[model samples]
Target: MENHDAAALLEQAAQLDAGDPLARYRGLFIGTDTALSYLDGNSLGRPLKRTQRDISTFIGEGWGGWLIRGWDEEWLDLPQTIGDQLGRAVLGAAPGQTVIADSTTVVLYKLIRAALATVSDPARTEIVLDTDNFPTDRYLVEGIAREEGLTLRWIEADPASGVTVEQVRHATGPATAVVLLSHVAYRSGFLADLPGITEVAHSAGALVVWDLCHSAGSVELDLDGANVDFAAGCTYKYLNGGPGSPAFAYVNRRHLSGLKQPIWGWMGRKDAFEMAAGYEPAPGIRSFLSGTPAIFGMLAMRGTLDLIEEAGMAAIREKSLKLTAFAVQLFEAWLEPAGVELASPRDPELRGSHITLDHPAFRNVTAALWEQDVIPDFRAPHGIRVGLSPLSTSFAELFRGMAAIRDQLRR
Candidate 1:
């Protein structure tokens, strides 16, 4: 499987696919046409076959048949119910700590604001983050800092390597109130040391918030074990929840009582159905919710979650490492000779499910590849992301995509 020759690598890919334990699960998802190579799963995943059937069933039976009765029977707690299922299968969190609602931006804002509200020290005036974080994350933190009159401690992460634990330690201190960062860098595909950074931020008396938009279902997460104070992520990418799927928010059970999310609505109030005047926050994770759940959008994710739970994250991670490793092997043999450089971390353990390669012509190369039915997304400053979704992608498919990149570079 580690052959340095392209023809040999293609042979190895087929051999690897023959024995792949997760190979059976690929049929569960849609978009299996051999004419294309989908290397953008980190941006948007393919919908599950079951998702279409489930959506039809929901509309016909759950919504159409039950009418308003659906709320009392199942819709009222869809957020928390699905959150628990996601927590158990992907997030490594216990029940009652995660809830699905809002977009990634809204959920991130709520969690960041909730953490900021808990800061009691006047000296804690800094919000630490990296320059390479996702655009929405940076915007939300900048907006919050400007509105709250706080300082932003920017961590200048290497665009290729991402924010490291030492960078976090140096950036956070007594002056830092909240440290926000991506669990995986969106552009470079660098996976951060979640537990180590959380511990460092805690020692500095700052709460940590993670944006899991890139890493959520692609990598194994232990929010509880890492002692992550707050987290927000989207279900559209790795979770395969469809476009415009509801995002999730996680608050450590210990912080539930004290955390005050900025947006308070009737849904977050205790006895919400009673229509009380004063807003008494609902106990536990429900208080983090600000509005009615997106029940329709969440339906597709359930089928994908079922597949994830059945495959197990450990198995998925194992397959991910292999696929990415094979990709790297191909790059060393073919793409590297064409002056294409690896922008993502070379160490497999330091990388996420995706890999980024840099070529001066990548912008145009991406455009050309799209015309030829090989898809990889172009990032700014000459980078192309090769995102591998373990359940839907095969080693042979990965080879085809990498070979296309190599052929285009030769042209």
Candidate 2:
């Protein structure tokens, strides 16, 4: 595709976007006065109008009126409430299995340690995780291994292709205590075969903990159907929870009864307010809680989850594939010939809601795009990530951003 030809195709994409069913959702976000073409929704989604209002109400009514009594009003139950909504809406898990608290890193640490403790055999002293898993996940796992004197088996995955079920099978053995992986590759946006990988880990007598930061709100997950052991994710991405919103963790119903959290804080005690003489874990997933909940962050997540439930995960995923396909098509036509390579998968089914492109000048190009109010993120070793949230991103915005990149490259 020549530069001129690519420009023409982008123009055509704009025309097609006008009739898209999800087009109107673009208006629901808080747009900037500048020409900000935000393609980084995978990192941090644009705040919804409803979220702003909810935050106001929370501060004014929930905190001011209820005061410390807010605990009795509904603050304590918000975690489970939002968790149930996230489960029914996206996680595909039963109630009492999901709770919203802490960040993704904290949740990962808690779950990984708990999982490792469960497999207490001396031979099971190894943790299996992909090299391509998010940096935070890898770091957390490494820290756990160091603390527990366990071996870290890093599965070196193809940077662009992501981790596979075959690779996971090869890496897992009798010594594998826990298998940690991300549902979607953060750099390549490749969606892992969750069910297949989970089956492989279980076959090796190991538990699996999935980082759903990229997949929770953007993809349709059947954690219950898949019999996944544990999971964690953030609300700030496609979930449209505000930045720094609370994260969620999930333990399978069957595992919830037996699993013991390593961080046994007061909240996880059977009678939290009893100020008990000894620690007695509460029944089910509540045992995972460590400290006081972030009420404001939880409220923000509640507002976002409400929107997700209303829209439905199936619907969100359907439009997500379409949006990513549209961006991939645009990239193939426009950037391929300009020394830009598609870093993400070409197959729609294997990809997530983002399309990544690789170029030698990606760092500079990304900085230039930001100056022009086109917001796409730069990953390490020359990769530019364009994250399109299906609920909020429009075809026009995608085309505009890609066109800007093309224009900048030509100069």
Top lDDT prediction, candidate number: 1
Q: Which stretches of candidate 1 lie over 4 Å from their true place?
A: 1-4
**What lDDT does the true structure give each of the candidates?**
0.92, 0.86
Instruction: Please give the distance, in angstroms, between residue 279's alpha carbon in candidate 1 and its true position after superposition.
Output: 1.3
Candidate 2: residue 254 lDDT (0-100): 85
Kindly give the stretch of ten consecutive residues in candidate 1 with the minimal lDDT sum.
1-10
Which RMSD values do the candidates have, in order?
1.8, 1.8
Q: Assess candidate 2 and give its TM-score to the true structure.
A: 0.96
lDDT of 2 by residue, 208-320 (tens): 99999999889999999999999999999988777798899999988887787788898888889989799999888888888999887766556557767787888788878
For candidate 1, give the lDDT of residue 219: 94
Residue 17 C-alpha lDDT in model 2: 70
Error of 1 at 365 (Å): 1.6
Task: Tell me how many clashing residue pairs each candidate has.
Answer: 0, 0
